[model samples]
Target: MRQSEAIACLREKGYKQATLVLLFAAIDQLAWVAGDKETVGNEGFKAWVQQYMVEKNPELLSGATAADLWGARCGVLHTGVAESNDFRKGYARRILYASNYGQVGSNDPTVLTLSLEWLGSAFAAAIVWFLSDLEADPEKDTRAREKLSRMLVDQQP
Candidate 1:
């Protein structure tokens, strides 16, 4: 699916904890696929996590950041509790809808479908983080952009 559509779905959902879980799962899957990893297991995920670090210009793993987000997602999914009363609904529906019907590669529909889901989730999470930055008083939005740029640079072997 187009990135815009994915973001729209996430926006429509508003912001919910469960959606956050799905979003992270999707991102984990994307990192696996992007890194050409075959499995999504713990070991595999560790390697997948490394992809994020390797992509960083300074080569530091944002383990603390990832762990905090992960812990929050787990709490939400397990407790059925939202830290905020304002639980954003319809996010999964939007993700599912866009993922199911997204227009993508002509080569392999199955792979494309998976990729679409992953990309949609990952991109959606990114948008949420970006928006949070505005609220968090982020001085800059260079981290993600810089890491991505470095990934591209390193990949050009």
Candidate 2:
């Protein structure tokens, strides 16, 4: 449901920031569920993105590291900025978005340009990949299920 909403926002003309927020939030939530933890700190978020998102969609996220995405996530969620402390401190590159995937370029070496559409698609693919992984691994599936059961959901009347 969250993935769908993110994609919907992505397809809209002027919802780039909202799309990013939802996409990043989905990553955080999935990371927590995948780890079977009630909470996931920065390290955990980075690790999960590295394993599940970056590694899974390298071409779409070329030149972007888990740390870069993590920094973006923090910046966007915390202050509605694109550059985080990590980017300012030389820890991660600042990210800019384009219209589609494979359209990456930036004059500044410390900055990266990616396609927001590609990002949304890649993230959706990552979720599918993660689900397949859980299906193949019973232990992981059980753990994720346990965590998911604890997640709050709107009750249908």
Q: Give me the candidate number with maximum lDDT.
A: 2
44-83, model 2: which lDDT tens digit per residue?
8888888877888888886689999988998888888888
- Candidate 2 TM-score, true structure as reference: 0.89
Where is model 1 more than 4 Å wrong at Cα? 1-4, 35-37, 53-63, 69-157
Report clash pairs, candidate 2: none
**Candidate 2 Cα misplacement greater than 4 A, ranges:** 155-157
List the candidates' TM-scores in order. 0.34, 0.89
True-vs-predicted CA distance for residue 83, candidate 2, Å = 1.2
Question: Model 2, residue 64: displacement in angstroms?
Answer: 0.6
What would you estimate as the lDDT of candidate 2?
A: 0.82
Q: lDDT per model, in order? A: 0.37, 0.82
lDDT of 1 by residue, 48-90 (tens): 3333422331112111233323333344445544231212321
